[model samples]
Target chain A: MTPQPTAASSPRPVLYSFYRSSCAWRVRLALNLKNIPFDTRPINLLAEQNKTPEYKAIQPFGAVPAFLEANSQGPALVESVAILEYLDETRPELPLLPKDPASRAKVRALVEAIAMDIQPIGSMRILKYIGKDKEAEWTSHFLKEGFSALEKMLEKTAGKYSFGDSVTMADLLLVPQFYNGIRFNIDMSAYPIMSRINSELETIPAFQASHPTKQPDCPPELR
Target chain B: MTPQPTAASSPRPVLYSFYRSSCAWRVRLALNLKNIPFDTRPINLLAEQNKTPEYKAIQPFGAVPAFLEANSQGPALVESVAILEYLDETRPELPLLPKDPASRAKVRALVEAIAMDIQPIGSMRILKYIGKDKEAEWTSHFLKEGFSALEKMLEKTAGKYSFGDSVTMADLLLVPQFYNGIRFNIDMSAYPIMSRINSELETIPAFQASHPTKQPDCPPELR
Candidate 1:
């Protein structure tokens, strides 16, 4: 499909992202799948770049994966899921959400299961507050609890991708979170459904390119 | 405006909700605002009713505010934000989201700011992990940080309600999160915009009726 036309005067879409941010990777995956070319401005989370006043002005929460539109209107869409929805709306070539309201709702529920339920639960700030000693346990506890339930929901929904054959918004959320599971040494064997889906997604170019190791800011050894 | 009628054979819409849960209260507010009649099945979180296997079947995440649609599709919409979207799409009488895409994106961003950033930060589960002695301090810190950033975003969006004079999805999220701030004794004076918008929302019937104190499951002391 031919991509949508941009106003010449408009700025190219820019993503303010962190290399290791699952939220940032979600946006990266969606952008790659949609075949929309955008520039990535890396905000280093580990070094606390997001905490700076400038970054906070961009995203009030000082979180990464904030998207600037081709026309760049309103507040920079700060939330990852919201940015996915925005891109899916404006760029409509490869629609991330299903057309049917019921299907869309289900996909969005899966989106939230990862985005809201799982991802936020393991926020670096929240994990740090829990203290360094138990960070591994704390992350594992939330991830396992969230993934087990998500695997059950995926049983009803997964065909090839997270929703059907198509790469809907759910898959965009799933891949980065699965990467998180890897970081925390989650028992992926327990979640056969997620494991199968992740394996299938690993072959996809968008999923592969959006991997944390491939990002511009990823450390050399990690890359 | 009259609400849409469901198919005669299909069951009435049901919302598994717990009163004081901010997440559940969000769906309650949306249902009320949309003027849809849904039977509330109270799953008391404090008593661990949500942890039961039966409730888990309905909501794989074991969270309250799972919505069973009139037609009941593949999966029950388990997240409050997604449930709000479902109700708005299914019953169009009261549009919880704006028609324009940009505005809708902004509204959803506000939704996530509350749903993802603020509400989940204070999950009773997470707070319990943080320990009881510092619970108030922990909740207060996250709430203040989240609300302060959100207040800035509200400046760009708020008119009479969260988005404009008419109530949208953002208000549903705001009212519940604001109630949570009260529980945590968050210093509200810093967020004049949120306080003002919240004050306006308090006068709305939907917002008032969905209060945590009004639900059947709420204990007498809370009511």
Candidate 2:
């Protein structure tokens, strides 16, 4: 039998995402952490599904992780940071941000460092566009530069996770980008704090479930 | 005589920012809009002041727009989005984000499109590293591509500003990136909606005061 909808108040929000997209992984982790039920409609990046006109209608930029909530909404929301904030504001239960404004800002700074500073430089399209010869070198250099700074930032702030013991937006952002770092063979020796935090975060069920390997569209061989 | 601290409850936040830096401008707009008193500590990017050990202590990333809040704080906050959110959360006087979750999401999405997708790619460091020969071409292509998507986004959501009559995070982000587009000579004709919104934003006093030309650190020729 088909299962009933998870949340009774409204239909599950539809998430148009890619299995291995770091940005999409951020939203997936947020959804799982908040216990907010959602349906995933995977847009395969390798297949160029994200570049289609149909996907463009959902996300103007044709990027992964566009979210459409049930009942009423004009169009699917684009940008993973925006989606995470939407869930935090609307759900307000699990609270991806801290109660204190200062602490919340700290969390956001860490998020942007990874999402904006690091991820965009290492994006698949950018790597492809930059040409194949320099892809490994470029990704390695950018990730290392970004991580060196992040390591120092975490040294001052990290506890069990990026912010503290509980997961916030920072942890969600860190995991996916760290996964990318690993994919590029970025040496983790320089980032002990980040390594420790990431190691601890891997044990969390929400993070585990959100791993790219566990996603429906991730390659079977890779899984 | 040197003036006493503006906010009695807490010390006035010291903003470590550069005049032409778009990321720094984002925080400047937020600080001005919120009417939260602040002192600007200019870090000259051209002079490589941001790369100094002194500045690195303030911002581990050695990036401009690190915010140091009053009294007790572990370290100054880096990243403009984080500083903006911190102001909105702590001050909460004039909210940068809307009350509704979806609307807030829309604002954040616009902000990310410029700050993440566009700005990082167009940053001086990245452009210089990309090599001077193709700098203008690469910047133009990236900005135009981003604006094309942003135009569509604004078409659906814009009113007087990016998210209806009042200013939001979208406006703060739009103004600086739009300025950069103009600098690169990216044709704005295709983005009528964005042009209209940006035109309106320029009239606001806070936005005017936060203009790159008005900053103390801006060189006379550039001004």
Candidate 3:
């Protein structure tokens, strides 16, 4: 995939991200799906480069996926979900949210279920809290619990995509979270519907280009 | 506030919530603010009401603030952010998200910053993970860090509310998270902007009525 300029006559929107971070991946998927031109500045999260003074000036949180809207009035945005929504709004050719309100809510719920509930439980720092040996058990427990709700909800709202096939913002969120589940070795078999949607999503250029293994900063071992 | 008939209108939207849970409080605020009528069935977390067979069937995760969509095609939606977005969508008279995408993203990010970053670190379970002795320190650290970001964000976004002069979804989210900060005995002096926003929000019927202290199930000590 060729990198495109974010601005017509100026530099592209710059995304500071780590390849493996699910949150960052969410933004990447959104940018790709919208065909928005962006430049990727891979932050060395593993190397503690995010904590440096220069990086801290842009993002106090020191989290990956901070976005710099070169021409936006406000300071650069730091959170991933915020960046995704902003991109969707600023460029709406292929929108992330559904046109209808109820559908939009369902999509947001699906996205938040993973981002808020499942992702945090399986976070690296939390694993460090319980030690690695127990991390497996912890991750498994949350995934099983979260996936069941997701599967049930999908059955309720899904058609071709997460919400009646439009491939709204929920799909962007679902793919990376599924990747997280796979990373933690959580069983996906129990979520056949989720797996099917993810399988469908993987073939799309947006998801394909956004896969962590495909990113410029992806580790050689993972690649 | 009188309850509004849910979409289906067969039965009122049944809110399965716990008294002290911040997620539950978010929904309460939305319901009250929207003037939607609903009956609340308290699920005592301490007594494990959520883990009951019937409750677990509705909420696989056994968390509070599960909304049984009275008439929607979808199943009971979980997650506070999702629920609030749903309410805002189905009842669009008083909008929760802003008109512009950039503004909406800003609001969602503010909500997520609290829900994803601050709320998770200080959750009852996380406290358990850090052990009782260190829990206070852990909670205080995250609250202050989150408040610092929130203060900056609110300063940028605040007019009369968290994201503008309008009472947006971010204000609804900000209230409960701020309550958590107060609960943990975190000093609010540094977060003057957030403190002011919270004070202003407290005067509104939406936020005032939803205070957890007013709930029937709220413990006297906690209340």
Candidate 4:
């Protein structure tokens, strides 16, 4: 796909991301999958770098995975799902969404099953704010409940990845959430289809390169 | 836009929705905005209708706002954002997404800021699960935090609605979340831009008709 022309000569897209943020990981995987040439500027969530005014200027929500388009025509896009959609639109070679509207909807529903239904409730900030005592239990319960439904959906959808053989938006969404499930020590044995797809996606270079441990700001111990 | 032909002489799209569910409200508003003919099958979330096997068969997540398309070939869509996108694509007459990719990205970013960042955490299920004691406090904090950023975003994007003069996907997303923020008693005075846009959108017939109180399932006291 030809890069969309911009008014000003644009530099490489810069991704403001945090190493361990699952949301950030989704965009990194998308950039690699689309083979979009880009650079990363790590925002340390632990250090509260994301809350600083400097970072807030890029993303008003102060969230990581803010995508600064090559051309500085508009504000840097926040929301990982939005960034993924933008990349897919601007770089449409390996289409993340299917051609058929219904098929595209199915893929998107699968993505949101994880992104909206599961991830936000289990996010660090939410869990921490709710209380530190039952974080593990809350995370585990929601993950199990979400994965139970996702596993059923994947039973009909998965071939090798979350939706048939190709790597679509669903797969990009799954891997990061799957990582979080592992971090929370959720019982993965119950979700056979998701587990299988996560393993298959792990073999791909795009998925491999975007792993949290491989990111530039990954802590020494984690690396 | 012409409705795509389907086998078995497909019926009008069926929307499984609830009156008070902000997520469902998003899809309801979208269907109205796109002028898609759909029948509502109200699922009483308070009654746990969404948790039954019958509902789960349609949406594995067992969530309100499951959209069963006119055709039966594809699975029912669960996520409101996904359902909105499908409606916009399949019924493209009054385009919900902007023609330009950059403009579309801007609209999508605004949508996700609410759908992903705000709604999930402020959801009834999440608040109930966290504990009833701090529910008000928790909801209030998250809404304030989310709207602060959204207010700033609208400063750059809003004309009459979230992304300019026309009713775009951003507007569809904002109205439902704004409804929730108002329910939580978040001080709306802080978010003047969002408040103004939301009030303007409320005047539109589509938005007015889709309000939770107007839905078939709305209880008399609430209505």
Quick one: best lDDT, which candidate?
Answer: 2
lDDT tens digits, residue span A104-123, model 3: 77788788877887787677
Misplaced by over 4 Å in model 2 are A1-10, A72-74, B1-11, B71-74
For model 1, the superposed segments whose C-alpha errors exceed 4 Å read: A1-10, A71-74, B1-11, B71-75
Residues B1-223 of candidate 4: C-alpha lDDT, one tens digit per residue: 1122232324888888998888888888888887888888889988999888777777778788877778674456778888888888878899888998778888988988898888888877777786889898888888898899888777777887888899998988888888788788888878889889989999999999999999888999988
TM-score, one value per model: 0.92, 0.93, 0.86, 0.93
lDDT of 4 by residue, A92-158 (tens): 9999988998888889989988988898888877876858888877887888988998888787677
Q: Please identify which of the two predictions, 1 or 3, would achieve the higher lDDT against the true structure.
A: 1
The number of clashing residue pairs in model 1 is 0
Superposition error at B89 for model 1 (Å) = 1.2
The Cα local distance difference test for each model comes to 0.83, 0.84, 0.78, 0.84
Candidate 3 regions exceeding 4 Å error are A1-10, A128-134, A220-222, B1-12, B68-74, B125-134, B219-223
Q: What order do you get sorting by DockQ, best first?
A: 2, 4, 1, 3
lDDT of 3 at A41: 86
Q: Candidate 2: which docking quality band? A: medium
**Candidate 1 falls in which docking quality class?**
medium
Model 3, range B1-223, lDDT digits (tens) per residue?
A: 1122232333678677888899998899999999988778799988888777666656656778888766553356677887887787678999988887767877887888888877876776556556888877777766787788677566567887788788888888788888888889998867888888899999997677788888877889977
Better of 1 and 2 by DockQ: 2
List candidate 4 stretches off by more than 4 Å. Answer: A1-10, A71-74, B1-10, B71-74
What is the per-residue lDDT of model 1 for residues A1-223, given as tens digits with 9 covering 90 to 100? 1122232324678888988998999899989999988888888888999988767766778888777777655346779888888888878998998888888888998999888889998888788777889889888888898999899788778889889888899998888888889888998889988989999999999888989889888899988
Which residue pairs show collisions in model 3? A6-A12, A96-A169, A161-A165, B3-B37, B4-B36, B4-B37, B160-B165
